[model samples]
Target: MTELLSLSRAARLAGVTRAEIQKRIRHGEMQTFEGQVAISDLLRVYPSVSLEQSGDFERVEQIKAEAYPRSHDEDTRLPSQQVLITRIKALAEALVQRVARVEALEQLLEEVRARLDEMAADAGDKSGASAAAETQTHTQAQALRDLSAWLQTRRTDLAESAVEAAQTQLLARDSFLRIMSASVKMIPSGHEFFVDGNESILEAAVRSGLRLSYGCASGNCGECKARLVSGEVYRLREHDYVLSEREKQMGYLLTCSHTAVTDLQLEAAEAHSPADLPEQEIQAQIRKLEPQSGGLMLLHVQTPRTNTLRFMAGQRARLRLADGPEQELPIASCPCNGRNLLFTLRQGDDAFSQAVFETVTPRQPVTLTGPYGDFVLADATEPAVFIALGDGIAPIKSLIEHAVSIDSIEAFHLYWSVPAPRMHDHQPWCRALRETLDNFAFTPLVDAACDDLLALLESDLEALPDNRYYIAGPGSAVQAVVSTLLAAGVPQARIASEELD
Candidate 1:
């Protein structure tokens, strides 16, 4: 029998994204059986990945250290004791079933041996039986002996194969991952993510960049209610909203208050586009204001815990300071963390930008509303090119982060052009992204002309018509890039642009 692994687990074990695995399958480099890869195939394709020193396991650790250094505490790598015990019990039951099957096979083998011995004895009693019958009995006994020997040898081969050290270690690592995190598969949309630590299902979904519908994250409004289709869950908090008896009978639960105890499948609502998200007004507090290069300010704000902002990445939000007019600015942070949002503000003569740049202190109250824009990423698996110019890097940054969270894009190429004086400001970040993501490339252009930018894009991309393009910059620059792409036979529907001016 062939040992098979799910695509998600195979990707985790191989230390690559699921999209990378799918790409290989699409290119006929790898094979799958019913959406699962054979363990032998996985090992063959990712020979560099193993549990040995400096292998796939260590590569994963390195990525965690670099990309998500503050993701969780070291002590929290294990699941809760109760959940751990349940998993162990499940494993034990599977072991018991296998053992019973082995015993039954042994008994059947003993019976076959006894029957062969009886046949051999009958063959020797030639006086009472015909000569032809005796000859047939002896032949049957010899054939049975040979078959028994082959079965025993085959069983030994299977036993040795089952204990292959490298594959054994791979499976052990997968079990360890299960202990640390539980996978969740959303129904209808078929989206998936892992629930790390003891975070609620809603929290994990949002953190994974899936825009699941929700109102109050504290479970007061029951907007996060979902029917449990499979897996175990534990309530992390008590919710005041009572479920109908019929809903309760159907396993309805509040995702905001429940944490997954095992891999789960739930019928949950998700926002596929910006239009799916409702208009929300959140009174957030200014977390901090950090000055960046080229007269730009990084404004950090934290929304209330109960009411977090719900929006897609690369969208704009209207922010207003006390006694100041609202200013619409592109959000510079990933939608993964709606509670703590970031905005990139150019410190121009505008009142809102000046207030944020000069006088906005930490914990200052700010009115945040209107996650307004249609400049969100498409739900396609094609390669994407992101072009950001100067301060326009804000929205592009959010889009890149969101794409990384989803880990579904086939490839990504980022082109960032800033004035000569501010060229070095974002280089460090671009370098980090290049080091972390296997499918990402970054090119920096300092005060580049339109020809220079277009030349780089033409040289970097394999095909212009096949990939999606997203551009953010001054209105004139964005229009120029868009026109060039359209003239190059790129479809208008494959391009998305945001004017930063």
Candidate 2:
């Protein structure tokens, strides 16, 4: 019997990103059966894969420790008791079925061996047989006995096969993982994310950088309603929003109130374009206002718990002060944390800048609206070149964080041009990123021109022609980088840019 593993599970067992597994499949290095990889094939490709090396056991222990006293607690890292029970029941049923099948196969094998023995005994009892015929019957009987022995030996070998044992361990860990968390696959868009801990489907979706349409993070609105295409989900909390009888019969569930009981396929609304996202107005409180070098201010704000802002990474938002001033700036934080938002602001003669720098304090209420701009990442699993000139790092920062959250980007190379003071402030971050992400590289330039930037990227052009390019800064700087990339044989469709000034 061959065990087929989902792409995500195969990646986990192989200790690589899912994108890496997909890349192998695309390059003909690995094969998939019905979008799932065979465990045998996985082992053949990733020979070094081991239970310990996969870190699955450690993860199990960690999640258990994190969710200790793991009953119905919603604040912990384990699913609710009801969800856990349902998953265990499902696994138990599957196990029983497999056991029954094994027993039936054993019985069939015994019957076949008995028939072979009968045939051999009958051949030997042919007393009237000629000498030549008797010799031929004896040879046939010997061959039949040998065949039976070979079949028994083969069965024993398979029962104790090292590959089979390894796969069994992998399956055990995977089952535990499934009980702890359920993977959600979105339809139409084909987006996928894991629902870990006790997080509702909506929460997990948002944390995974998915721009699913929702009116409220709470369960009061039915905007988060999605059809359960397959798999099981249990209600973690009751919702006030009532679904129609027809909708309920058709498997509709409120994502904000339900927890997945098994891996799920959901027909949910997701935003793939700027137009897909609706304009939202949120009254957010200032959380922190810290001044950094190069006259830049880091303004942090937290939205009301029930009404978080909905936006994609690398997008801009319009911030308005009560009876003061307003400004439109690129968000500097990833969309994973919709309630908590960060913006990079340069102190300028603008009224909004002055108000934010001098008057804004913690707890100040600000009206935020219009999550604008289409400057977001496009190929989630591609190597990317990010060019940030001056304050363009703001949006670029969000893009980088979003890519990190997605956990599928093959590689990241950032080329940032800023003043000496700004570069000094950015070095620690760049160094930290390099130290953490093995595939990340950074180049900081002080007062560099288009020619210098182009020269620095020449090697990358030769090495990564498929790399997606993102340029952000002053309009002129963005234009210069775009032209340089285009002149270097990069397709225009592969390049995206945003002007910060």
- Candidate 1: list runs displaced more than 4 Å: 52-77, 101-144, 162-165
Per-candidate TM-scores read 0.89, 0.91
Residue pairs that clash (backbone atoms under 3 angstroms), model 2 = none
Evaluated against the true structure, the overall lDDT of model 2 is: 0.81
Q: Which lDDT tens digits does candidate 2 get at residues 190-240?
A: 778888878888888887778888877678988998999999988877889
Error of 1 at 27 (Å): 2.1
Deviation of model 1 at 198, angstroms = 1.8
**Which lDDT value does model 1 have at 177?**
71
